[model samples]
Target: MTDTIRQRAEAALAEVEQVSAVVLAEPTDANAIVPLKDADKPVGAEITKRMAEIDMSDTQSIVSFGSNAQAELQEISQSMLQGVRNKDVGPAGDSLRGIVSTIRGFSVSELDVRRKRSWWETLLGKAAPFAQFTARFETVQNQIDKITEDLLSHEHTLLKDIKSLDILYDKTLNFYDELALYIAAGEEKLSILDETDIPAAEAEVEKAPEGDQVMKAQELRDLRAARDDLERRVHDLKLTRQVTMQSLPSIRLVQENDKSLVTKINSTLVNTVPLWETQLAQAVTIQRSAEAASAVRDANDLTNELLTANAKNLRESNKVIREEMERGVFDIEAVKQANADLIGTIEESLAIADEGKARRAAAEEELKKMEAELRDTLAAAKSRRDGVGDNAGTAVPGA
Candidate 1:
């Protein structure tokens, strides 16, 4: 019976080792690319209205005029200064002087018409408005690019987190599977040791002859000692099983959280980033267009709106990523703790099993010794009784 218990215990331990090996062998890295979904195309109604309100006709007509006026003014001023330096009053000098006067008159006349608008209007809305629009547009574009980069970084981190959770999930499920099998095997062995074999042995010891009551009593004690040791082994196995069962919920909770995190990450990658990209492209187009003052104003407003919305989304997404990362760390630690506890329980169970085997061996050896002593005592008693009977018969009535 002790031998059977020892064998069963060893088998259970082997199962535990096998389960551990499987968990350790699982791959920890993720290899697949996360899929991205297409973003919705931006609406063009506001952009069309703003473009229509902007009258580029006047600006286009004056574009070449401004360039010609500035060029002629520079050339004439240089020529007039050079003539003064040479002190020339001949036909060549007079011709240069007349050309300078005519260019200056043209510039003054053009200035009178162009400068009729207020300085603020020229600076803010009329003079080279596209350049201002471009500057603002590029600024917001840069911001959009930065946000996109941050989102991608967060996406990568989330992927790693998902992989970690996947590994933990697999490991936990495998551990539970192995644990259940080990416990089942252990319970079966305990049943045989406690109910079937040990009881049968005790019954055999109880069937001894009346004259051998003392020997029978000693044998019964040995059987009881072995039975008690086996029961203790069973108790230890059950306790370990209970502890293992208690840890399952924590493991399962981590798995569920991991799934939730993956969904969030997918939403950002597939929908949010693409939508931002579309809006960014639309803003760039508006900034580059040669529209009227009203159109540029509308574009500015639209760009600011998009920038605000995108910034908010990016910030929110980053916050969620950080929170998920923190949770992932906690889940990993929890899994580690659970594994440690299970390993400790199995080790303790193994130790108890070993001790039970030793006790059973001692009981068997002690029982053998008592049986030998009982045989010797009975042999002596038989010899003494036979001698007394023979002597009584030989001496007859005289004795």
Candidate 2:
């Protein structure tokens, strides 16, 4: 598909290169050559009447007498200039030049290549670069189509104007023919004045009476000045014809350009746009296939990793569960801690009992010592009192 467009594009460019130069047709109308168009029109009766009233004694009046022809020639020149202006191709040319490269850019953009996406993005679905490019490609395609439509419309206008330019080309040639007739007509008038009127007056001057001779000579001088002015007007009209000639080829060139633009625009619309769309579609299809394959491979790899991790976790969990199942209700470490705590309580109680017993034994021994001392003291006193009262006691016992 790309090759097809390339071939067509090369052909289109060749069409532009081979656009033949515009060959303008020369004037061939018998009426334009024989009977002058505007040149044959009679001058105002007012101007002709005023010419008689002007005194021959004034040289300025004589020289400026025949000026209607110059006025008409100037009018023709202005009309020709306006016609050229009306047929201008600048606007169309600028429109073509501005958008040609811009439209071409679309056909050769990054939309042609499908970018590779990273593996990690598979879960993010539609996050691939190719997916983004598909969206971008769609937007670009719409824009190109829009531009193509606009250019095709413009080419339609250009085609019509190219035909219109041909008509204008002919009209410009007609202006040239009209200007030629004017120059020729003015020269014919100048010829009669120079050959017939001036020679007759000069011969009459040699033979007329002295007073009438001076009057005839003044008339003769006025005739010669009028003739010279007419000739100058005719020369000026010839210059106007030159302007018409130059405008011919310029119009043809514009028409030629319009033709070339039409060809190129047609090629872009018919060939380039469709080819680009095909390529973009193909690129998107390829990328989608690649992404599907990558996503599947990526999903499989994830599944395997998850299974391996689950197996490792299952092994650890089973070992811990079996150890729990095989054990007694109380752990030995807790029992040992409780047993040590009980022994410390018992030993402390026994030490307290032993200390109390020792104190009681000491107390018993001290009590015995004290009691013996007291008894000894009392016996001694009693013995003394018995001896002293032995006599009195024997008497009291008798009483």
Clashes of each: 1, 0
- Quote the positional error of residue 380 for candidate 1 in Å: 99
Give the clashing pairs for model 1: 54-292
Best by lDDT: 2
Q: Each candidate: what lDDT?
A: 0.47, 0.62
Candidate 2 lDDT, 281-319, residue by residue in tens: 886787678768877987999999999999999999999
lDDT of 1 by residue, 288-327 (tens): 4524555677788999999999999999999999988877
Which 10 consecutive positions of candidate 1 have the poorest summed lDDT? 31-40
What is the Cα-based lDDT of residue 226 in candidate 2? 66
Off by over 4 Å in 1: 1-147, 160-167, 200-260, 280-399
